[model samples]
Target: MNMNESFQTLNFLPRGKFKVELVPGVSKTNFLSICYGALTTIGLLTFISYSTNYVLLENLAYERSQIGTIVGNLQVIAEIVLLSIFLPIGLIADKIGRRQVYSFGMLTMGLAYFLYPLATGIAELTVYRVIYAIGMGTATGMLGTVTADYPQNHTRGKMIAVTGILNATGVIIVSLFFARLPKTFADMGFDQITAGKYSMWIVAATCVITAVVVALGLQKGTPTEEQKKIPYLKQIKAGLAEGRKPRIQLVYASAFVARADLVIIGTFLVLWGTMAGKDMGMTTAEAQSAARIVFVTSSMSALVASPIIGYLIDKVDRIKAVSFCMAIAAAGYLSMFFINDVLSPDVKPLFVLLGVGHQCAFFAATTLLGQEAPKMKRGAIVGVFNLAGAAGILISTGIGGKIYDVIGPYAPFVLIGFCNIAVSLFAIYVSKTSPDVKEA
Candidate 1:
């Protein structure tokens, strides 16, 4: 069968069908460079993320604390909005040209981050973030499509996994080094808050420069008939069905659940730590510093694990990897419930477990999602996966926060621990059987 017809069989979204400009054995250096650029954006995000709820701390709480909730809400709300928006963006990339979409996304990141210093409250911050989310949705959908544009899957996974390591690199950079930039500026008599803002401005500048390099250096591919043969709307019906396979669905579900666990940590675990220990002798910053240690350590481990996981994903059973990851994470989370000395100087080991457990799940989930999603409908598949994961964040935030408020600070950790264990079992049971879909 021809490439067009094979794509027709994989029908993703009615409008999402775009032709692959990738001639078999095409050079991947361009794609690799672009992925590296995207990783820089990830690093930029890691740095600004610490500022997301900065105002909510007891210290920053008085600095217009109400805006904290609003800023936090922007991320959740944007995730939902992106669900609807990126579906078409993916299809558009398929139809118009992916280079257009990719460049636009970087520009959005540049612009969004540039505006960070000016945002003073929920309303202004929300506007800037929504733009960032739109950029994110575009990048999320396009990266897999761009990778598949290559002829090989293994090579594709390797390149993509490199980006994952870059993500870990970004996290470690901001957590370990960005935290200290403030003091450097303070030595020159700058206010701590002003110095922090300068750090964000630097991240913004990096994104802007990356966007420029991509816009100028990257070549654009012509649109193809892979999607032109089908109407955009009717295509989703065919796409989801064509794309659906039993084992893939189970794997897909594993990503959905695993990412949900991750989103929970990204959204609320740090907040939970500070709130939980107000009377236990640790200040919010101290709790955050301790948690940052976990993130830094895990980010370091991811540097090593990413390529290996990428290698194993295609060769070994993807589900088995997912199951093993969930089991370890479950053990780590459960350990929190039983350990009494969470704040002891010796509690540092738990951070390593938290890091390893979470990073393993992250590496596995992204590898699986990209591997399993059909080229034609990657946008919708990613959208659905993201939708489910976003809901995970929403629920974790709402439920975890409420539990902490009603039960005590320690309640959320206990909840997370039990959840990791339970979800691991569910994922394993699902993976035991084969997915009904055959490999394309």
Candidate 2:
């Protein structure tokens, strides 16, 4: 459909009210947005991605990394804080309208970044981190929902991949930016952490600008208070039901479990690398770098893989496709145990395989969610999918952290790989049992 037709037929709005305004798609605002959106994306990523830095540079990798005792707890608490408000924030979006609240998320995450340098102790850092994470949570929850608002699936996978690329690019930004901070702080006669504080300032400034740009660029139909007040759970439940074609269920099961592996790696990889280094003979920086490499590579691949995966889903049996991708991811995680035993000196190259597997699985799973979701209720289905993914992060970061401390560092990935593979097998079994497993 043409852009005008897409706007007019958007069933989420009143039939007569959805108008296609003939306006410049890229205004003076797009020029500003290019910069601001990158910044906002960066700021949100720093808090989420910096944990890897902390893992490599400090507690997990080095004995000096004192934040470990509290880091996992802080992450868990903050994610809870984020997730606790998810369904409600979604309700709030429907009630107050998406642009205003989503813009606030951009602003919220930027503002949240400002607190990173204030860490006097673990307690203070954790509290501040929780606040920062909540802001990112809002962006995380809303971005895809907003993007797919009009439902153009042919390129939808590409858009989703772009989101992941932007997100990973943000990680690279923080990584590169922080990599230079110690030198910058030294030049300015300040401490490293003090200089790092300015990163958030940059992030926050960008968010404010993006919020304004979004306010100007796109037009959404205004909802009457009556339309806005549509009962939250009822609509969400209906959307879930509407979206549950033969394909969506398989996607959810595969995606949720596959995502759990990510949750584990994000939380424990650096810590595990660091722990192994004591005997394996490596430095803290090297260990953390090991983990960071895994994340960067895995995330970067999504930009290329996501859209292709999306196209594949539309053409093939989505259940089998997603199942195969997840099985590969499981093997990636399982292969890690061999790294220390075999590679011993360093194990970064092994991650190329891991990255490929993870990208395929993650994008395939997410692509399926997009395929199965109804045009009218994309928000609710996306919310639930993210919620399930978030649940995986919660379990992995919280419980995984504890396990890393107590059970031996390899414990988390081993568990994640086993669970992922087992689940993929279960999904495949389920797919075979349900003959009609295809998207609407």
Q: Which candidate has the top score in lDDT?
A: 1
Q: lDDT of each structure?
A: 0.57, 0.56
Model 1 agreement with the true structure over 38-156: per-residue lDDT tens digits: 56655555544555544334323433323324434555676676666655776676667666777687777767766755666556767877887777666655654555454244444
**What are the per-residue Cα lDDT tens digits for candidate 2 across 175-271?**
4454344345546775434444564466566667767765565335322345465677776786568545545666556556656655565555545
Q: Candidate 2 — which residues are off by over 4 angstroms?
A: 1-43, 49-69, 187-189, 206-210, 222-229, 239-248, 258-263, 270-295, 301-311, 341-346, 435-440
lDDT of 1: 0.57
TM-score against native, each model: 0.78, 0.76
Give lDDT for model 2. 0.56
Position 260, candidate 2: lDDT: 64
